[model samples]
Target: MAIDDLLDEHEQSERVRNWLKNNGAGLIGGIALGLALIFGWKWWVQHRDQQAQAGYAAYAEAVKAIGGDDLKQAQAKVAALREASPQSLYAQLAVLELAQAQVKAKQLDAALATLKQVAADSPMKPYADLHAARLLNAAGKPEDAVKLLSSYDSPSALEVRGDALVQAGKLEEARDTYLKAMTGMDVASPQRRIVAIKLTHAGGTPPGSAESI
Candidate 1:
């Protein structure tokens, strides 16, 4: 071939070789890092799924123990599940079950303490607070129940607050709260009838009742 063409080809080959030599280590490192990340993520997902399965097994056992009225065994299984998988959904459910079992056993203080362990950000927190408020009311601490439910505006929460207010002799406020609760509740709800009775008992007329009309 021509000398000029041969010289040009030789120069292009040298340039390609030089570029590879300069960037080879970085390219290899990038590939290695990509592979490590892919494998690491897969391993982490597998480990998480395995942990969830184990937690579910433990939670099921705890529930079975609770149903069988073996409180001690249920408590032990729940504690173990909590210790082993504190952040798991199954652990949270197990704690709620344990609290219910405690409440059924008339261990009010223990139930409250168990409910208190529910994380504030957990979806279960509102239910836990509801149970605690009921327990407080049952224990004749209506003021504490009112205070505990003060942050919530749900119909159920408002109903509980109204009950507490009635117990505390704040009849006017109780009537107002019951009215609000009824307004928020579904018209067809069975609980709405109960709340209406409470409102009338507190000297308030329900919105659609003949007396209110």
Candidate 2:
């Protein structure tokens, strides 16, 4: 190389060394932080997946025990799952199953208490409330059932509320609730037909029915 070219190359090398000397610690720290974040994310994902798997396994055991008529074992498995992973979907399902088993055993009060264990913020909470309302209605607490379902406006909720109203001797409100329940249901839906029967029994005419004409 010519002298000028060699001098230029040496200047560039010196500049690079100076830059490194000034920023090397920061550069190393940035790399370490990046690697730590990457590994930390991987660990979090793996831990989450393992917890899900464990919850699923525990739920399966609970279901198997329920199927085998071993209520004690089923209850134990469900308790373990709930204690270990209370917020998990599998834990919610297992608890629901336990409540169902309790209901089938004619332990209505126990079933209601079991249903209450479901998280209020869970997606399954509405279903749990519906079940609890039914139990209350069956236990001759129709007014309580109506109060329990007061905040819900879903079709199923409305229908259950109507039933509770009817039992509570609020036929007019029951009919109104049944009409609301049938609002979006297809004309040919079996559920609509059932609701229509309830409406008629409540001394109200079902809309679109011959009596309503």
Which candidate gets the maximum TM-score versus the true structure? 2
What CA root-mean-square deviation does each model show from the true structure? 3.5, 3.1
**Residue 188, candidate 2: alpha-carbon lDDT:** 77
**Tens digit of lDDT per residue, candidate 1, span 42-79?**
99999988977887888888889878777878878888
Stretches off by above 4 angstroms in model 1 are 1-9, 209-213
lDDT of 2 by residue, 1-213 (tens): 776576777798898999999999999999999999999999999999998788788889889987777777788888888899898898899889899998989989988988999998899999999999999999999999999999999988999999999999999999999999999688778888888889999998899844352
TM-score, per-candidate, Cα-based: 0.86, 0.91
- The runs of at least 3 residues in candidate 2 whose Cα sits more than 4 Å from the true structure, single-residue gaps closed, are 1-7, 210-213
Model 2: lowest-lDDT 10 consecutive positions: 204-213
Lowest-lDDT window of 10 residues in candidate 1?
204-213
